[model samples]
Target: MAKSKPVLNVALVGYAFMGRAHSNAYRQVNRYFTDCPYEIVPKVLVGRSAGPLAEAAGQLGWQESSTDFAATIRRSDIHLVDISTPNDSHFPLTMQALDAGKIVLTEKPLAMTSAEARQMAAKAAALKRPSLIWHNYRRCPAAMTAAALIADGKLGTIQQVRAVYLQDWLTDDACPWLWRMDAGVCGSGAHGDLNAHLIDMTRFLTGLEFSEVVALQETFIKQRRKPDGSGLGTVNVDDAFLFLARLSNGATASYEATRVAAGRKNYNRIEINGTRGSLVWNFERMNELEYFSFDDEPRVQGFRTIMCMNGGAHPYAGSYWPDGHIIGYEHTFVNSLYDFLVCLKNGTDYRPNFSDGVANQEVLDAALLSAQRKAWVTVEQSQHFAGRAEPTRVAAKNAGL
Candidate 1:
């Protein structure tokens, strides 16, 4: 008989869009990924209202539900706490869970600013607890393959990177205001909510940090009816943002993110050009990677769309289906959850950890500052902390200029 693996209980807070996606991952991951070293059990779901708790719990497969997040965090039976709340709530909730000695996982753009993120990172390090930020896009098989190819020097001497994440949900002028539109809750509109993913993906694929940034922001719709239908309120967040940046590897890049880009729904795309070859991937076609290699025979030289459904080469495809049968966006979250469990089983550190979160937050903060000053700003405002992991040569030069 085989020995049974240990089980990890999860307490998830919030039950909105991200909450639904995360719940689906927790419920389905164990069923599809039987080889994961531990079984994930959704122990409790936390929400602000008791009225919807029961319904959400039933739909999400949680064993129980709670109207109080603090009480949920204090439960000794809970082994992991997953936070999907808004920006303002992240720091306090995360710190409380970490203080209780639970594994902490948070949705991206770690906190409202780099200072808050740095403090959380320090606490996690001091406690020596495994913490992760949900930069789930990195788990997409095509994206992972891109990272592998880049690491293998297939895209040698990277020169330029271009990325954009565009959505059309808020394009309408009549769209109601929500927490995401409030800077107090969401930090910086599309810059943090959407661009954070691209920034993290940029760092993950290239193994480089942002050196400096020059940015611009726009608020297309300045006011809208409140969700509560009370009255009109100021829409203080940017509807669109564009920035130019230099990476520590001496590569230049352009990034654009917006919620008001008409006709572009979830069209997150990335193109990287290098001395030896080039690569491109888009979330719209989530399972394909377009490749062009200079080493290819002249007669056959062109971009080839490589289907990444092959389980052998892909990261998380084998467990689902045979080659050519592709997965979708939700599977990325499942893969991330599986990876987190594997790390727990092996007692290993999770990638894109809090340190990476802090690094990404630094870039987001610098972009906002650059937009404010109308001048180029170094990403590492405090080189003393930012320069600890990566060398500060690029940042130093930018600061002296």
Candidate 2:
């Protein structure tokens, strides 16, 4: 008889976009990661409406559904609480879950404000519980490869980074206003929704802390039809945001995020230029990493495109399709979940934890402040915690690229 795996019962809140993604990851993680220490069970699907919650639970492979969040999270059987709600609710749900002694997983942006994120981080630290914020892009095999290379000094004294995340979803004035448009809910529009990933990724790849930032932002559409069909609602968040920054290591960086950029849809791109080499990663071609090295002979000095789908040499690629066969965006979430579980099993630390989330929030806060003051704002990043081990650094070693 085979030994039984320990079971982890998960209670997931919210049933919207991120909720669907997290649900898919939870269902598929153990299927691919057979060595996973826990038999992850999508135990309860919690939400505001019973009908939609029940429907989503069945479709998403959850065993049960409930609308009572307070009671559901407090259930002794629940071991993990995943918050997929809007940005405003992150702090409250996380605090309650931590009080219940449950491991917490939250979507990006962490909270609507840095103060809230700080409290969340502090509580988790005081309780000595591991809390994770889902910054899934870091798990992309190519991105992990880039981190590994930079860590090994292949980038050799990084001097600059340029990152942009652009989308055209709201370019049309007809696009109705959602919670994302309300600063009270999402903190900021493109700045929080998109640049949050860029900020987190740049740090992950280079391990550099942001020193200061100067920002400019705009709200292209001031108002739009509300979801309730009531009337035009005010669009209080930024439609576009851009910033320049200096890293702790004296490296310079630029970042931009926008939903009004024409002809661009989900174009999350980043390029790093260093003393010895340069690296580029784009979400549109996630399986490829563009690399240039000064070590190459003058005749062969052009950039080389590496197909990161090689199972034997790429991080997280060996878990799926054969070499040269690519995976999709969904797989990144699974990789992150698998890594988090492995961290739990090994009693190790995980990246993008509560403290890391707090640091990311600090940058966002500073950017917002900079835009308001029309001056550079120093990033208060004392909370940025470097864990004992990071999955990407490990994957980079395995790839040896």
Candidate 3:
């Protein structure tokens, strides 16, 4: 008889957009990537209300459901705690899960502030628990391919990077206010919710830390009706943010993130220019990577798009489809889950662990600070955690994907 694989039981908190994405990933990851040593069991789902909790449990394939996150996290059967809750709850729940010796996975923009992220990082470091923040874009084959090429000196001497993440969800004033628009609950609106992803992606692909930033933040809709139609509430956070920064490698970057763009529906794009070549990736055309090489004859030099669907040749692509077939946004979550489980099996640290969260939070803080002071703010300020790790080895292999 074959030996049984180890099982890791997961207790998931929250059941909204991120919650559903994570649940789907947990259900699908092991099915496609069978090489991981452990079987992921979605043991329980946690949410605030009874009706939605039960509904989500049935819909998302969780065996059980609970309303109390504290009780769920403390359960002995739960070996891992996945926090997909709102920003305000991330710190407390993550700290509790780590204290209880449960492996933790949380959604991004780790916490409302760097101080909170630092505390979470310290706890994870001290306890040595497997922790990961779901910066899922890092797992996208196209993005991973970009990282591999950059690491291989393909984008030699990075000189500039331009990234813009735009959405139209809140373009109309009638769009009801939610926790995301409130400063206290979800940090800094699109500044954190959207720009955070770009920051992490830039850091991952270029292996460069942000040195300084100057930014401007704006609130287009100052007030909106409450979700329940109770009353109007003040919109204290930014609807848009644009920033300019210098990276540690002496490269300049410009970033713009907003929910008020009229026609951009989930448009996240990045273009990196270097001495030898340039590369561009747009989420709308996620399966293709556009590249321009200086080595080409001057008469013929132009951008060429490579479809990043070559199976087995691309990182995390083979498990999904044959060459030329495309994967969607949801597959990114599955790829990240595969990486997480692999790290668990190998007893290795997960990439973009709490330390990365803290580092990203520091950049967010710098952007906010620069916006407030109207001057460039150094990312390594007094409050920034000083013990951040140096550039570690890139976890993904250099392949065609």
Candidate 4:
């Protein structure tokens, strides 16, 4: 005679890389977080082609498929709209979902520009609709452990952050042009796709906002064959972007994101330095954290590698395998969705909501502006971020930092 839980139907857009990742998260969340508050139904998968959509739907475990995105968003049965589409589509899709009184979860870098992100945030806030952005790295158990240690003053008075997200996917001339290489679709290439995570992770680990940045970017190969094999198209986005920033806490930071890093495939790494200690978490070795503490006895002072998968201690660990057992990248998405569902059950606001997206987008747009101008740009570039929620602090300090 247990009380039945209410069902929350999800209509997801896109069925490619992110679409598959998100679909897996939705399916696995309830299974792992058994105490999860709702019966999450992966109701419909929406995409451009009915054939591919149907095939992806079946493969990804969604119950339905549709090509009509507008109709799907308006469906009363759909409680959540998941916009995993390209950067150009996020603002419009989220705005529609918000207008329809549906909660939304979207991929990162929010929108094509800071202005678009602000509008989405304002609309979601005004309509009182809940929203989340899938900055899944913040949920990685090792990353969360870094946050906790930083929050506990292990990394006292943060001084600097260094981050890089590297890949080799676009290093080859033979790699055809796709939506990602087009600025009109993805905002910025490696900067938006890779550094977005680095930027957000810096803010999450230190609880500090960016003050200003000086940046430079480069496009290695200017053109590539179009996806349709219809000759070549201009590659308008940066293949590599590097920037230095001044953080709100007077800390210094640097970031590098590139798709031209030969022999490097998904080397996402972050390191933080403070007065008393330092920590590094590389997604390449995601389950372990390297720690160095000046406070330790001088004889024993060196980096110690701590494995973060202890079910008794690490966040999200108890939900999975036994102590010392590791998890792969996809588990981060599951952890994020599980947290979002818990927030829904308690009627509490979720971190990295629409407002967080606005914050992240502002940093992104500002960096691009700085690169274009070949000068420093403040994170709050006035006209660009007018009427936006202050990006001074993260949504709130959760999971310690």
Candidate 5:
């Protein structure tokens, strides 16, 4: 009999929304995706609060819990360090793990600033270890299928990309201001929390890098009561953001993200138009991809809604469910972890690496700059962190400088 492959020990930091989502993924990925070369075992859960941390560990089926993140990352038994902590801690924890020569998996908006993100990416590149940024939306079956189609020339030369992510959680003035409202903790509010997803998806589907962005940012409710009813706290970040972008592929992109969209609940939608065809996706209706092909009959050339079933034709879909059976938001993390595990086993570079995280952060930086300056700003020319040279800002040829 052959010796069994060693299981990959996993340690997760943070036990809230994203923490639980990733924990569930670790628990479920191997059970469904049997082809996964290494078994993933939940090793440790780390958090600041002791009570909730222990409860989260029990609920998530981790072997143990700890408040010291440094100890968790330094443990010799843990093979991978998953950072699901707040945005402010992502860079420090990830940097420690990388310096320790451990593989790291981190939640998005990899750092508070593009310069920080770039430094982290540069470190990972230097170490040549497996470092993945958790841009889980890219793992959606519909999005992945659409990306393949675009890559295969099925969409021809891409012309435009429109992406919007809207949620109603902050619609009410009575909604207590949380860490997400703080620029110090959450970075640029909805732009980092929500728009980052669309920006990454835009790059994922269209294979384009943003050249420049013109953006407008707004803070709808300026003041809100604290969650603990401690008077009122001023909202320091934008509740919503809108931007127009030019992509390196010569495609145009329009992006909008809002936390106060009245009727929308977790609405994430994207549409890509190319010379030959087009594709669209909505998270509200996760299982469907609407597509249009000009090659079809002219009379019936309108978009056709294609139900995405993972059973046979789709990648990673066949393993878990049959046709028309939908997977939810949590499953995206599972798929992402599965890919990470496979890459670990095969020594392959995973998609949406830290470099991708830095790139996405650069776009976010450019958007913020554009909003502040009230003009088009090129992403490549923005200054990310302290002591970094300014990025080169070149006017588009069409702009007629």
Candidate 6:
């Protein structure tokens, strides 16, 4: 008989929206995917206050809670640190975890700036530890199906890509000014919160890197009363952003993100055009992928929707529901956590690591520069000017010049 492997003990930091979402993933992954090599158990929850942290831990099914992050990371027993903290703390926590030789999983927009993201990436590369950036949107069924189709050459030579992520949470004046409204805590507003997902999805589906961008950004509601209602605060970051970009593969891409879109509620949509066919995906209808094949008779050419029923037929589908059954938003985090566990078992690097985080930040930096300069800005130029190392040669080569 073979010796059983040990379960991976996870210490999660932050107990808010993302914290709850990730904790649910840790609980669900092993329950559904019995074949997973390493079991993930919620070992600890870390936050600012012991009271809130303890309450969150109990509610989220954690075995224990701690107010000190350094002490949690220093524990020899904790195998992984899942950071769902605000943007400002991502770098410090990730760097400290890497120094302590623990695996790290951080929420997206990896850091406050490309330079900081680069430093974290370089440190992780030097230490050779498994670090995953949680771009959970890539784990969606439709998005994964689109990636598979494009990779299989079903969609030949990608020609263009367009993405829009819109929401109405901040459209009304009554929406309280949270951390998201403060640039000091959240980095850029809608661009980082929303466009980061869109940028990564485009890269995932098309396997292309953005080379240049011409963009515009705006702050529709410049002032809003603080949550305490004591006074008003100025909105320093853009409420909306739009851009035109060129990919390394000579493809054109357009992007838009806005928190002030009145009717749209968490609408993240993507469309890809290629020489042979095209694909489209929308988060609102996550279980379906739309495809258009030019090979069909000219008169019959039109987008056809395919239902993504989870089972042995689809990647990761068999882990959960039977065929034709549906999954929801939380499942993406579960799938992502499952992938991290597999990588840990195989001693392999996970997808969308810190380097990818830095690359995404580079695009965000370039978009900001374009918006400020009122001209097209090259990503390389922005990165170089910002004093960060250029993306690795492997990234450049895989981008398909």
Candidate 1 per-residue lDDT, tens place, 1-401, comes to 86787888999988888999999999899888989888789999987677797899998899999876667778889999998878767777788789888999998889877888999999999998888999999999999999999999998999999999999888997889987887766778899988999999999998988999999999999998998989987778789999999999899999999999999999999999999999998999989999999999999999999999898889888989999898988899999989988887788988888989999999998888887778899987623222112212221132111
List where candidate 2 sits over 4 angstroms from the true fold: 381-401
Worst 10 residues of 1 by lDDT: 387-396
| lDDT of the candidates, in the order given | 0.87, 0.88, 0.85, 0.87, 0.85, 0.86
Candidate whose lDDT is highest: 2
Residue-wise lDDT of candidate 5 within 144-205, one digit each (tens)?
Answer: 88998999998899999999999988989989988788776667788999999998999888
Show the colliding residue pairs in model 3: 314-401
lDDT of 4 by residue, 1-401 (tens): 76777899999988899999999998998888888889889999988777888999999999999887777877889999999988777877777778778998989889877787889889888887778999999998999999999999997899999999999999899999987887767778899999999988998899999999989999999999987879999888899999999999899999999999999999999999999999999999999999999989999999999999998889988989999899988999999998898998888898778788877888888888888778899987823533212222211111111
Measured with C-alpha atoms, the lDDT of residue 31 in candidate 2 is 85
Which regions of candidate 1 fall more than 4 Å away from where they truly are? 382-401
Output the TM-score of candidate 2. Answer: 0.94
Please state the error at residue 333 of candidate 2 in Å. 0.8
Against the true structure, candidate 5 has what lDDT?
0.85
TM-score of each: 0.94, 0.94, 0.94, 0.94, 0.94, 0.94
Worst 10 residues of 2 by lDDT: 387-396
